[model samples]
Target: MDGGERYQEFDPPKALRPWVRKVWTYACPSPSRTIQRIAPDGCPELILDLGDPYEEADADGVFHLQPPALFAGQMTRPIAIRPVGPVELVALRFHPDGARDWLGRSLRTATDQRLNMTDRLRDLSPPAGDPEAQARQMIDWMAGQRRDDWSIDPLVRTEVEAIHADQPSPPRDASARRALQRRFLDRVGIAPRTLRSVIRFRRVFDHAMAEEAEGWLSAGLDAGYFDQPQLAREFRRFLGCTATEWAREQVELARAIASQSYKPGGPEPG
Candidate 1:
């Protein structure tokens, strides 16, 4: 079922801009609602459920209620979430290596899992009216904890940037490439090659969804995929379903965040 949802996002403070993409909040009054498919898009998020805790289902069919506050790592595959009641949630979507700065830990543990972070945010107040103000409050809290010694590695940043660029070829030197992979795995919680594929796949999906494509072939070529079959293969590999099947799910939150431009914010909650 489609939930009439309200989403709002804020530009992070200058000090945290390099690591933070945007902080956003989503609210929907429909209770017992399920979002069946969340396609992987390479972004990592710290989420806080201000209204109701949701249940998450993994690939194996195992279901568990997610924490009210948690850090969700890079999901290379589809995951499902169902809220037990009407929802009000806030989240911070981090840059590729941004979690390292905020979590003070390796992202490897967080990948494909909702690692509980509720304890860390217990003292902070939830955003009451203004989503932007709350986002800044969260940013300030994270910035206050920044360590002088911590920063995203220069090499890692360069490699991630290359993955997002038009051409994503890795280093020519085998040894150099291996070293880059190690650093990427350590900091980003996934192998360099895997990250590259996810990034590439997401570009196509985003393009396809944003523009009203006539069919997958047009989207595939536009996204730089080798062929329509290649795009289909990647879609099944990452999302465990055909692109057409996924389209039927109508994942509102995912689509809202993925839009090229944010829809205007809704009226503040009472």
Candidate 2:
């Protein structure tokens, strides 16, 4: 969907453009626990308050934790919630670029280090500058691809198709290819090694409702997992919840939103 009022879901443009942002309704009736989940890109994430009171810092001094060091990419946090109060800010997913060739970098990483988004935006790039223009400049200087800004470019879809095929990388050149790959991964902030895994996991949503209805263990295998244990481990590591738990919460949230989402001749969700 275009950046107008039509946008209702996640969409990111190519490297040379501004990434699309979508925000759904608030999760008012949902639980209040600060559910911490990670995105496929390995970016750090946290569930927003969604109209409820949420504290970033917990009692243990764990300040609303950020993503892992190995992770650095655009982040899509909480799923859209409907049938609740109208939310001021909709959901968000990042099209990260602060890591320089790395898919991302650590917010806590010190300067004299690689590029960081917060630092670049605040310290380096001026606040008055156009963000999209700045992002484009950054990608160009770094010799990276453009953002997949839907209409003009379909790189995101192309990558999605390739990832869905579960294809491995082809043979490399005689040079230090492995080193190059590592360097690229570090620059991208996302190790290429984890791409398929993340893509496959994200694809779970393609049939989440149906498969999860049967059970996550079975769903995981059907979705390419070897066993329930394997799926469980990854789910916990990525989603911060067991398969059963995530499913239950999803079902609840979806159910709560179903009615509003299905009004006859209602606007479609992008």
Per-residue error at 56 for model 2, in Å?
3.8
What is the overall TM-score of model 1 with all chains considered together? 0.87
> What lDDT, from 0 to 1, does candidate 2 have?
0.36
TM-score of each: 0.87, 0.47
How much is 122 displaced in model 1, in angstroms?
1.1
- List candidate 1 segments past 4 Å from native: 1-4, 207-216, 260-270
lDDT of 2 at 268: 20
lDDT of model 2, residue 186:
39
Best by TM-score: 1
Report the C-alpha displacement of residue 54, candidate 2, in angstroms.
5.3
The lDDT for every candidate, in the order shown, is: 0.71, 0.36
